[model samples]
Target: MFAKLPFRTGTTSSAIWQGFAGSVMLLLGSLGVGWLASSSVLIRTPLFILARTTPAAVICATVLLCLGALLMFRAWLRLSQHLSGWNDDAGPVLRKALILWVAPMMLTLPLFSRDAYAYIGQGRLMQQDLDPYTNGISALNNYFLLGPDTLWTEAPTPYGPLWLWLEHLAVLIPANSPEIALIPFRLASLAGVVLLAIYVPKLAARHGFNPHRALWLAVLNPVTLMNFIASVHNDSLMMGLVVAGLYYASTKRAVVGILFVTASIAIKPITLIALPFVGLLWAGSRAGWVRKFALWAATLGISMAVMGAMGAVNGLGFGWLAALQTPGTIWHWYAPVGIGSVSLGSLVDWLGGDGTPIADGIQKVAQVISILIVMALAFVKIRLGPSGGLGADLPEPQRYSHAVMRRMAWAFTAVVLLAPMIQPWYVVWLLAFFATTGIKDGWPLRTVFYLSAFFILIALTDQLSVFPWISMEVVRSIAVVVAVMGLLYLTLWDKKTSELFKRNKPDQHAFAVKS
Candidate 1:
């Protein structure tokens, strides 16, 4: 089915052109969003003139931003196709595309979430010798100047101690200068992107898959670029380290893998679930099942000890564990648990009973069920035996690595699905790992592609701070029309229709070659 795509014949040069165009559009979109949502400190003086705060101006900026995001998604698809089978070295082409894709984001303010600013404020708290886990960013005094959302000002950080330890570097920058401090975190996120770029293909190569395609699916993905680089989220860091650790463990360096994955857990605890999969990769099929399970258990124990010691060293201890429920407070329809909670809560209220407790109980139960499902998948993967590559007769090591990758992918997917709260960026953790497992031209691929486009559009539209000048109904109508038209062109009319109209030429050598 993938063989019929028109972009399958596209060249690297054409793909790069599309990438450049996408970046330009993304820049325009980002600028629009900045004008509408960012504090004046984050916006350049000229941008204010270009993107006035009035309703019409905000609407126009929204259109421009949406158009840019859509164009970038289109270019990314073309680039992925170009990288898949084209024999010419993709390194230079990919690097150029990466630069175009990521450079504009560095200059943009945080887009989807105020988490980065929260990171800054938390760092300030730590710098003042206050325990960030016990106290909120407001403890820093005059922290509102940093533009952190009021929501998190009094809310304790939900991030792990290591993340806080690393974020403390922001305190070295002058006080009350949010924009300047923002640069360091953005750079750190960019570094994570670089790590993914460096390691994704290497991991793919070890398993006999096309490295370029893996890079395209994992690093060049629109969802990844938007959340990891554009919004400058720390998930990028955790994900990169997780992938690199998995690669090392698959290649027979279990210690190195353990270290990398441990760091990833410290960034955010979700990747901690990946340790068992790494152990499976390390043990391979030659080891007894008991030994494999033991290795997995050992890895987890060591990882926990390392993480605990690090937490102690920072003096933050395990306070983040208590704050794990923080995300549940920010409920939205996008989160599965949130949707259930809202619906159940509403129903209970209609039944003349207290609703909040019942809804919270339902959410907790759903989360626990998701965790159990993940554990079940992990055990099943271990017992399923070798599962990567094509056919029977592949090396045991490669096969084992492939199986581990699939299991790790499933574990991350479970985390995203079951978490009390989820955001579009959470998709990145699953997508990055799944990409390395060699998924090409299947339902899984299609799912990621469509989900990426849908969620990114949703995130862009929802994150905008609406103005009173234009009725939201008008904005919604216009956005819907533009989105439908853009999606139709990109997915159906642009190339699919052209292919349908072109006449099929007869095969010149089919009959003669038979003789």
Candidate 2:
């Protein structure tokens, strides 16, 4: 039945170019609708002026951006179908696709986020020798006029010392111009993208998964390109280093791997989750509890030493620990914590009482539950053997590696889902780890594909800086309609893509290919 359907018969190069063209469209559209600051030099550019002045231009750009996003999504879906057939050329094919798709994004202004502007402000704070972990960007002159969200004005930076240092350097290079500072920030993110390109496939290969499929899901997905490249989030570098570290650790280079993971923690403390698994990898699969405990302590000590050194360089001294709770302040309607708190808070409000405390209590409870789940996943043993021992079907090392990667993936998944604010990019953290274990071509793969599409749509609609003269409702409605139609076409109208949703047998060819 599957063979009877007309799958899109084209070279991977075709899909590559299709996505590249879409990125070009996205770049052009971003000029008008991206998160541009009021003081942006682009505001004086003719394209910006034209898009802002004419309602038709704004609508058209919005449509183009939506269309471009859908086109890229479709191209990604098409490329996924060919994963089984890819051989040694998979690396080159994916690299080509990445380069082409990222080119336009590099040229465009920041899309779907103004966080880059915040990085500039934070960097400016560092430039003046101010402690970014303690002083919000609001301390700078004209900070409010910058493109960052006002929420950050009084919020100390949540980023770690290495990232703050990089931010300082990025701003220094541009002579404190926020607009020009974007270049260095984007480049820093691009470097992370490069790290991902290099390491994700290698890790997949080490885990006995299809490197081609893993690369497709982890590196070329719309989520990675849009957030890591377009929005320039520091999480890109963080995830990249984590992937690289895990890869090295799995291959018996524990010290090198720990250093890489430490660097990742310096970028964002979230990857600290990867350290315990690193200790497991270091202790070897057959080690006793004593060895495991020692390795775990060693791993923690190594990470702390690296972190302490980073802190000493700037005298930042762990102030970021206090600011780590800052992201929890945002409440997204889609998050589990957010939903639970809001629902409970509304019930309390209906009873004629203050609900803020109830909401806070709910968040705290959810956080505790998530932490418990993570701990269970980390420590619990999987009894794969008939007599309650490790499975004998696979080698001990293979079993151990698989167990560690699975736990790491689910641990991160638990954190992201239960967090107070679930950003679209946060999903990238788990996706990278999951790819190493392999996304089987069934509901698991389909779920990831659809989720990526959903997040892309959310990102596209969520950040449009609507012109005051135009009706925000009208513009948003158009974007939603266009984006939904495109998604429907991919889901039902396109013959090749529609086939993706079908419950077909797994492709053996995918795993048969040597990494």
Our tally of clashes for model 1 stands at 1
What does candidate 1 score on TM?
A: 0.87
Candidates' C-alpha lDDT = 0.72, 0.82
TM-score of each: 0.87, 0.94
Candidate 1 lDDT over 1-515, as tens digits, reads 01211234447677667666766666665554542224345345676555645567667866876776777777787765565443335656777888887887787767767778788888888888888877988887677766677887888777777788777888687654566777777887998899999898887666656566777778988779888877779988888888889988998999899999998888877676888788877777567879878898889888888878987898777777777767667676777878878788989999999999988887888778877866776666354344442423446677668777877787777767766678888888777777677665645566667788777767666665444555667665666677667876776677732232224442211000111
Once model 1 is optimally superposed onto the true structure by TM-score, how far is the C-alpha of residue 82 displaced, in angstroms? 3.5
Task: Indicate the residue-level lDDT of 359 in model 2.
Answer: 93
Q: Model 2, range 70-186, lDDT digits (tens) per residue?
A: 899988988877544656556677788889999999887788888988998898899898888888888998886678878778899989888988888877774434567788778
Clashes of 2: 0
Query: What C-alpha root-mean-square deviation, in Å, does candidate 2 show against the real structure?
Result: 3.3
Clashing pairs in 2: none
- For model 1, state the Cα shift of residue 319 in Å: 2.2
Which 10 consecutive residues of model 2 have the lowest summed lDDT?
1-10
